[model samples]
Target: MGQVRDQRGDHIRDQSDDQSPDESTRKETSMQDSILQEGINEVIGTTHLNAAPMGIILRGGRHTLALFKRSHTAANIVGDGWFVANLIHDPVIYVESAFGDLPDDAFTTEIIDGTPMHRLAAAEAWVAFRAEVIGESSEAYSILLTPIKEEVLVRSIRPVNRGFNAIIEAAVHATRYIMNHDPELEWLIRHHLALARKCGGEREKEAAGMVERFIGEDSL
Candidate 1:
């Protein structure tokens, strides 16, 4: 009886070991599927009419040109050609506004052209632009805009490092602007900076540190 029980236990253990790889693979696949499905659902659920499209021109070095077209959707920008989308909550009028008619061969016209990833890139670009703008602003405006700016910054830092840099740069610019205009807002900016440093991941934390250093020592 003892021998039979031991053999049964060994057999059960062997079965479990054999199934482990398959189980793990299934779990991984399921997770990936969930993520993909969630992304699809988000795109579907989003309302596109409220947001505006921005022409994303990617220029490499001096001559390489990649033009990506995207539109603001649900506080982010969705590119027509990529998988990841950009999260630009407060888009500038200049970026969002159309100056001239779109080109005849513009990618925005077709739904099947760009991927969700391209949209994500556009969003990141917008964030970077915002960061640069904000980093040059006055202290008072930074204070007034802190809540919105910080919200955008947090979102920007989550997915891509480039996006994180954009948000940080923008925040730094805004801080500098505020310090130049209203020195009193520096204290508030510092407080917010501390909060941002504590909230994000490693990259975000690094960004927060950079922002704090830039703003803290900024001459303006």
Candidate 2:
């Protein structure tokens, strides 16, 4: 009787171990599906408000709407860099607005410049900015869409930080391509440099530098 009980226990343990990965994988897939659906809903449901000429849109209510518009515009043009930058910068504005004070004029002015450097800087600064904003603001993070296994996989809805990171990654690749062959836009290069400074993190800074080096002054 003892031997039979031991054999049954071993069998159950083996089955449980075998089932774990399958269960985990199913849960992950379901979560991914939900995320992907949310992204589609956002893109489809919202009206595209043009803060600028780009195809970006501003979502949310009137108060922070302009900021969202501007941030989206940057993201559309530059990708993740803008998202990251905005995540950092939004809190600065929030703090100023809360205290009935204004943010540094320089910071606001630089954001309008919309150069690559400025964009990069915005992305860098956004890392810290996002944390503060999340702490203070009720705004929720956005979900990300990625291609996986013949369907769009959606990851966790990140607030501005993750959204910005996503945009930065895309922008970096695009910037690299543009820098390697097309170099007439000196202004664009400067803009990217400004963006690099905003990135604040070492990896982002390095990526921005790589883009800058690729488009040398001589080439431009």
Residue 120 displacement (Å), model 1: 6.4
lDDT of 1 by residue, 1-220 (tens): 0000000010111111222233343333121111111111111111122222222222221101111112232123222211221344321321221111222222121132221111222232311111001111111111000000101223334344443334333353343343354555555555655555555456555555554554545444
Q: How many backbone clashes does candidate 2 have?
A: 30
Q: Candidate 2, overall lDDT?
A: 0.26
- Runs of candidate 2 with Cα error greater than 4 angstroms are 1-186, 217-220
Those runs of model 1 whose alpha carbons end farther than 4 Å from true positions after fitting are: 1-85, 88-181
Where is model 1 poorest over a 10-residue stretch in terms of lDDT? 1-10
Question: All candidates: CA RMSD in angstroms?
Answer: 23.0, 22.3
